[model samples]
Target: MDENGKIDTRTAKGQATRDRLLAEALRLFAIKGFEAVGTRELAAAAGTNIASIAFHFGGKEGLYGEVVRHVAATLASLYQNAFAAAQAESRAKGEEPIRRAHRVIAKLIAALAASNRSRWMSLLLQREFITPTACFDTLYEEAIRPCLEEFSQLVEATAGLAAESLDNRVLAYSLFTMASAFSRNGNFLRFTGKTGYAPQDIDAIGRAVAGFIDKGLRPSA
Candidate 1:
């Protein structure tokens, strides 16, 4: 509200500018931690002036907080629908739990491949876990937890473990770590060797990733 007690509204252009700043901030922050980056750098990268950050996000620190929320929400929106469809297909077909798990993992891997295709948001997400901030808990709760529950459910079904058990959570985290590794360091991985994994090769990469996860979870008997 302004002095007149009227509600404030952001114009379309204003919102676009704010979003652009967030995008650039996320990219730079992913490559270089927040403390290392300055407001001037952000303005230069975002094509806006330093005052704009304070105007839109309150300040540099505030922008960082908003960036976390934006990225977390983005991941959820990007994957939740895809996940739901995979789950529905699995249930309708009465697929074996392991097969269903394979499908889920494959889809997840395919998504991961393209996650960093157009933006740094995906890498930015991975960076959070490496050096957590105040927003980590919110990210975990609003985005990570739901996704983890789904993966853990599949793992539990495949492994005959109870829900949310220590074993299940550990397995889930392990799977997550493996799944997110490629996107987090896709360029570095490519530099090391092609490894026959390319984000553009969605089906091939999905099969490879899903197969790896499935085999890793196979029963001893």
Candidate 2:
């Protein structure tokens, strides 16, 4: 606290510095994992010195918590916004819940798969899954759990699955994994010798996913 009552790091400049550190930390952590990343590298990447992390976040671990929050907020904006937007559009049109759910699925595919940062955040999420960290539970509750609840409800509405059941949970997870494959396998595009698709292409992919989902949701062949 520099002998004062507090460090007074709440100034605009300090906040900006803290933000930079969090951003660089997420980028590095996403690639290297938490244990492999060093505070010095984080400082360098953020164009700040090491002490700034201590002043703002208390240390690397604290900084990582902040980064986790940032990642959660980012996903909320990009992924949840897509789902919400599609559902709103579908409802406003007087579409059935099944159709609205289809829109949700297609929008999630495009948002998570095509958006640039989502690809990185997916990598970060994998790191979290591979080994639980201090931020694991918080991140799940703040970001993932809510996402699952929203998804499960959509699935139940679309497929007539019992709510809050194991079946609905499993169904939601499977669908999430399939759509996430877009980002997880994005690098495979180079194999196809084709350019990357845009986020807007969700509409086209929606048609395909909706048709596929409808087939499964149907009563009989």
Candidate 3:
């Protein structure tokens, strides 16, 4: 079509526009909180029209849900990949399942630390926990509960414990709590002089958490 004859794809441009909109919307939601943002404001922030939001995502609430789901799905995929890679590595090295679980946990923490969206998800999750919203059910059913269940099974199997045992459930909750706390409040704790761990100190904290949970889950002597 031109002197150089370079083809321009409409699909690619559309995808780019959608991604840009999502990115801007997420940033605004993170800064202003979801309830504080309106469709017109989101559209302007995204450098698009209000109609674009409705066309691309149905409506404002739909856009918000999609954003949340996008971030959740990304985090879930990262965790799943980390778990699989850890398992493969452990098998190659002939490491015990318990050690593999610890390695997986460490990998998860490192992955979370490296992800900006994961950090935002953690903040959003903490907010949800404190002030439950209608979206809470969707998030719980779609993301949180499934992750907890999978993690519970993994922890129980790694520990050589019965899955339905009280100790196993308690250990699962403790590990989940520790992980969520580390992601949500680790920076705040360091800022307040309560804990000195730096943002990049995931390995040390991971090891400590693994040891603490391991001991807590061990069968009574």
Backbone Cα, N, C clashes tallied per candidate: 0, 0, 0
User: What's the true lDDT of residue 87 in model 3?
Assistant: 81
Q: In model 2, which regions exceed 4 Å deviation? A: 1-10, 113-115, 198-207
Q: What TM-score fits each model?
A: 0.85, 0.82, 0.78
Model 1: per-residue lDDT, tens digit, 54-164?
999999999999988888888776657556877788889988778777787677666766644323666777777778889888778877788888888878888877776
Better of 1 and 2 by lDDT: 1
Candidate 3: stretches off by over 4 Å: 1-8, 131-134, 158-161, 185-200
Which window of 10 residues has the lowest lDDT sum in candidate 3? Answer: 1-10
Q: Write the per-residue lDDT of candidate 2 for residues 83-171, one digit (tens) a residue.
A: 78978898799987777667777777766676456777877876787798988887788777777888788778877787688988997
Clashes by residue pair, model 2: none
Q: What is the Cα-based lDDT of residue 191 in candidate 3?
A: 75
Residue-wise lDDT of candidate 3 within 113-163, one digit each (tens)?
556666677667666667766677766776677667667787777776676
RMSD (CA, angstroms), candidate 1: 3.5
Comparing candidate 2 with candidate 3, which one achieves the higher lDDT? 2
| Native-referenced Cα lDDT, model 2 | 0.76
Ranking by lDDT: 1, 2, 3
Q: Which is the winner by TM-score between candidate 1 and candidate 2?
A: 1
Mark the 10 consecutive residues where model 2 has the least summed lDDT: 212-221
